[model samples]
Target chain A: MLSCKEAAALVSESLDRKLPLGQRIALRMHLLFCRFCRRFSRQVLFLRGTADRVRGEKEGEEPPVSDSLSAEAKEKIEQALKTHSESKSKP
Target chain B: MSIIDPSKGKGETLNPENWGKDYADYLFRYALVRLRDRQGAEDVVQETFLAALKGKDQFKGLSSERTWLVGILKHKMMDYFRKPSRELPVSGLITSEDPPEEFFDLNGKWQVKPSSWGDSPMDALEKKEFWKTFEACMSVLPGRLAQIFALREFEGLKNEEICNLFNVSTTNLNVMLFRSRMRLARCLETNWFGKKAKGE
Candidate 1:
């Protein structure tokens, strides 16, 4: 009998790869009786769904958070580019 | 957009001088979301620009400059994550105490059973406000967990690829992924779904 801990681990693994038939059956049996684990299995799927959506959005569409790279960092990057380009241009 | 005659090359130009002003934020945001480290993100974005400059001659203009730069940035970010120096910290992830213990008891039963989150997880996902909560959850995730999660889910790397990159066994990799998903699921439930359930 797989414990909830073991069951939940298998649930997560199911998302990453195919599970062996034996372990899959054990997990299904365990989830059959455990409402918490069932909710957990569903929520784990939910997490995956949410994660994919979060990454699927087009880049530069404006992050919900207003944070940006600091001005000093931007200045520093520009300086590095300027130095490199100048060095390349020289003999 | 003007139609280009294929015989006459498009001659898309590279203005390396204005790249910082034009694309720095775009690249930084992409890196920051995946790397989740301001310093690391800055370093990669800087590295990307420098590499682009060094290889500017290779810019055949098949793609837009911004597209070319982002392609370089993606490679840079992968290197940043896979660097040998980072192994010291990432190794710590392998040795951390089992996370399932936090949720399960000595008998391996759930300490706190997961509560009903109500219907339509998709509904919450579609809400603009949910992203704020999701970002907050991601920001608070332990650094190693966040990195693995980003590589797996955000970058959509295959499990075998990540296993090779991190040099962990399949079981170990699954454990890491499990822990991260559990943490993220719990965080979203507590912060978003659980709140909605209670009408708070």
Candidate 2:
């Protein structure tokens, strides 16, 4: 019987790669009896969903957060770009 | 928008004039979220614009201009993460003690069973404050661990690629990832879900 600790580790590892057949069966069997592990599996999936949002790659939708540049940073970038263009245009 | 006429060969015009108006805010926001530092994020955004200007002719236009700029910014962020100075203190993470035993009991059953997040994790994700809390949780992680998590989760890099970048064995990388995910999930549960459960 895979302990919850062992099962939880596999839960995370499974996200990275394919678990072997025996280990998969073991994990599944463990999860069957363990509501906690089931909740844990869901939590891991939730974490991935949140990560996708952070990456701005949520499927078929706009990003959840759309923070804009700060006004000061905007001014600084504009000034830098202006200087860059002027220098480039110079002989 | 009028300046982007492909037929006019204005596609070759890598104008810095419009970059700020068009892409600066978006890029800044992207960097700020990941870097989690206003000054560092601003610096990288500026560097990205300058680098894009220098290499603007290389913009094949296959991707959107924003996409192209984001590519530059991603690389810049990667460099920042890779810096030795940015590397977090390697006390707990680098040690052999990991995934601490307390997560399971003597018989290997859960010492602390994870609680359900209730229905619709999506609903929680949709909230703007959720990302802020998520960012806060991420910030609390050791810097390198957070960077690895960002590269995997945020940037969607393959484990193999990250292993190569960090030059650690797959085992070590997986351990790091497991720890990172566990920490973030627990933090979110405590800070976000737990608070919500209490009607906060």
Candidate 3:
């Protein structure tokens, strides 16, 4: 039987790649009796969802985004762009 | 002046005047969450616009203006990661410490079973505070690990692409990803779920 540590590693690895059939079978067997590993798997999925939301992936369903650039930052960018355009227009 | 002329392209022209109004906030937020540095994020957003302006003629209407700009911004982010000074010392992120005893016993059996999070995780997704807490946890991660995690999870880059970007072997990348997820899970469990459990 795979230990919880090994099983948890496999669970995380599964997220990034296709697990080999042997390892997949081992993980499934381990998860059958391990509540903690099961929870860990769920948590990994939740983390993925949270990260996706951060990237604005769940656009329509997610709540309004709370963070944004401050007015000062916007002004700075505008200033920089103004300089860039002026330089482009120059001889 | 109307900088973007419809006669020149199928998509609406990208007006320089409206660049900040149209994309600054969105781009800033995206960079802020990934880079976890307001000043750095601001600089990146600014550079993205400047670069966009230089290449405005190449805008072929293949994608939305926002998507094109974001592509530029993503390249800037990858550049930021590639800089030597920005690279964190990744040696001790995962292997240095002993595994937590609660998760496994000496014989490697699970000593503490993971408790159900109930519906709280899903519910928390709708709350602004959840993202705040999430960002806070993400910010505390080691820089390289956080960058890799964001590239994989948030940017949806493939494993081979990520390996090429970081110039690391696949085994190294997978190990870093596993450690990054474990760290974030533990962080949310303590900072978000634990606080919610106490009604805090």
Candidate 4:
């Protein structure tokens, strides 16, 4: 059975699928027999999934979006850019 | 999403609008993720374009065009984030646990399983309520953790990219990423399994 430290380390590598075959086999064998390790593993897997889901899920399943800027903000930047260019060209 | 490109350089040779769709959107999304605002994304886009134009003569045959453009975007973002005025917020531990013990019980035993629950995980994931529960648990996450988790896991950006964007050292980034994964596991246990514990 994998020790707690070994099991914990595998949790993140499992996220990336980077564990080597031998270690993976060891981890899997340990997970098969250990109830507590099994729950810990399940939680880690869930976290990765939730992070992705929260990022992409829309109220309508449209898509998770990082907030977009409003039109007014875009216009403000444009005006600032114009002013910046004007000053640069003058001097 | 509707495509966006500034009209200022219309019909002109030196313009990002003239770039391919994928490249433009990649930079735009990257900027959007970092700045967390649209107008800032646009200005970053503009700055990237202008920088690319000014350095157009330096485009050696070495790197691909898209890669070069991304490099400019990186510089723009780094400059923006590195500005002295704003502090970069990092995540803090809540309901802290001492190392080694927090991770493992007194007898050096795991607190929970590493693999799965009695039910299918994919099923739990598909439910809207499950996500809601997860999000509520997550929203209270420290601002620093939210960013690291979003970039590393959600955005699928590399650790190196995160290190570069946040100006965090590799060890610092690794620790942050570790804490993030650990914190998420703890939250999931509380959100999904703690009820079962009460029943038992």
Give me the candidate number with maximum DockQ: 1
Which candidate number would show the highest TM-score if scored against the true structure? Answer: 1
lDDT of 1 at B89: 58
Q: What lDDT would each prediction earn against the true structure?
A: 0.84, 0.79, 0.81, 0.60
**C-alpha root-mean-square deviation, candidate 2:** 3.4
TM-score (second chain) of model 1: 0.85
lDDT of 2 by residue, B81-148 (tens): 77767654556344335655556677877766677788987798768898788877888987668878
Computed on C-alpha atoms, the DockQ of candidate 1 is 0.68
Measured against the native two-chain assembly using Cα atoms, what DockQ does each of the candidate structures obtain, in the order listed?
Answer: 0.68, 0.61, 0.59, 0.31
Considering just the first chain, candidate 1 attains a TM-score of 0.80
Cα deviation at A83, candidate 3, in Å, is 1.3
TM-score of chain A of each: 0.80, 0.76, 0.77, 0.59
Give candidate 2 regions above 4 Å deviation.
A57-74, B1-15, B105-107
Off by over 4 Å in 3: A56-73, B1-8, B90-105, B110-113
| lDDT (tens digit, per residue) of candidate 3 on A9-91 | 78988998899999999999998988889999999999888776766653323323457888999999999988998899899
Please tell me which model should have the higher lDDT, number 3 or number 4: 3
Over A1-91, each residue of candidate 4 has an lDDT whose tens digit, in order, gives: 6786566667665675477899999988887877666666666767777667645534324323333445564455445545555555585
Per-residue CA lDDT of model 1 for B1-200, tens digit only, reads: 77655356565679999999998988887788788889999999999999998888788776677879988998999899789887745546744355668888999999877888887777887688888888888889877778888889878889999888888777778888888888888898899988988889
Q: Which residue pairs show collisions in model 1?
A: none
State how far residue A63 of model 1 sits from its true place (Å).
Answer: 4.8
Top-lDDT structure, candidate number: 1
lDDT for A75 (candidate 1):
91
